[model samples]
Target: MRLSLKVWRQSNKEAAGGFEDYKLDNVSPDMSFLEMFDVLNEQLIEEGKEPVAFDHDCREGICGMCSMYINGRPHGPLRGVTTCQLHMRSFKDGDTIVVEPWRAQAFPVIKDLVVDRDAFDRVISAGGFISVNTGNAQDANSLPVPKEAADDAFAAAACIGCGACVAACKNASAMLFVSAKISQLALLPQGQAERSIRAEKMVAQMDAEGFGACTNTGACSAECPKEISLENIARMNREYIGAKFSSSAV
Candidate 1:
């Protein structure tokens, strides 16, 4: 199939950026979205032109690095799938696709289709961990976790930190990503020690990172490749409130 692509091109974070169009031929329906880009890049390179730059790793979709806002949706129009997992069959022959990077102050573009997501790492560093050493691995039966909590924790842990939540939000909020991180731990007994402080510090750091405020719009969850639930955001709010109250009571 042949297709037209309007992709964002930026030399650097400070450089002015705009959409550049290109036509691609011989695209296979089975080719993943990134593979299509690879074909385009190869064609440009063969012509001695600078290839379009995009982020991708572990093309199997585990890395969450294939971040392309395609046709105004993060990771294309698919549900519960990342850009690396999106296939060209989702489009039609002679179609025009618009692709852009994640748009958020905290995720400034470093180059074409690549944004600096280190802000997420900083937020995680602020409190997303359990510092308490529980020693070596214990028998699974030794600490029997409630089945419901274990399931919920596992679901929350599926978050790949793709920044789709931030990209999908009207306010560019990272609340969904931050909440999933908090919930994955807060629901597990292993994360109990840092519960209150985790919520406090992470939320503070999220704010400091210039991420926008969440207005309870469900766009983030709807677009999240993991489909991380809005309930995690609610849980995070409760955790933050409880932490603040506990600190003030001291």
Candidate 2:
């Protein structure tokens, strides 16, 4: 397959950036999107031109580090797949692909296709954890969690913090990602001790980081590679409201 890529390029976070076009020929349909970029980079290097910079850790799609907005969609046109998991075959021969980084104030572009997603890490640090004592591991049967709760918790925990939720939102909201993190713990018994505080702190931090409010547009879940549900957002809203009420009642 042959492709024309119009990719964003910037030298640094403060540097002005714009699209630079490149033509690629003889691309394999089986090649992952990152692999195609690798080929492009190699060609640029041989020509003494600077290579495109993109974020990618595990090509297997587990890391959520391959953050490219392909043709105006997060992670290309595929559903339930990350950028690294996107195949060149998803495009047609002679296609013109436009690639850019996540476009949210919270995720400022560092370079070509790499954005500083440390805002996510900061949100996680605010309160995305359980308070468990350090000791030998407890028996799995000790708590005896309800099957429904357990299932939901596990599903919510599948979120990989990819920031697609933010990229996909018209408001650039992090609600889906934040909700997934909150629900994963809020649904589990191990997370009870910090339940009341988790939602408040994380949501507060999310706001502090300049992430926009959830508009209920559902774009976040639609573009999420993990298929994290919108129900998580509802759960988070309940958790936050309940926490506020509980605190005020005291």
The best candidate in terms of lDDT: 1
> In model 1, which runs have C-alpha deviations exceeding 4 angstroms?
248-250
Cα RMSD to the true fold for all candidates: 1.3, 1.2
Best by TM-score: 2
Q: Using Cα atoms with residue i matched to residue i, what is each candidate's TM-score against the true structure?
A: 0.97, 0.98
- The whole-model C-alpha lDDT of candidate 1 against the native structure comes to 0.94
- Pairs clashing in candidate 2? none
Stretch of 10 with least lDDT, candidate 2: 241-250
**Model 2 Cα shift for residue 131 (angstroms):** 1.6
Which stretches in model 2 have alpha-carbon errors above 4 Å? Answer: 248-250
Displacement of the residue 217 alpha carbon in candidate 1, Å: 1.5
Task: Please give the lDDT score at residue 162 for candidate 1.
Answer: 89
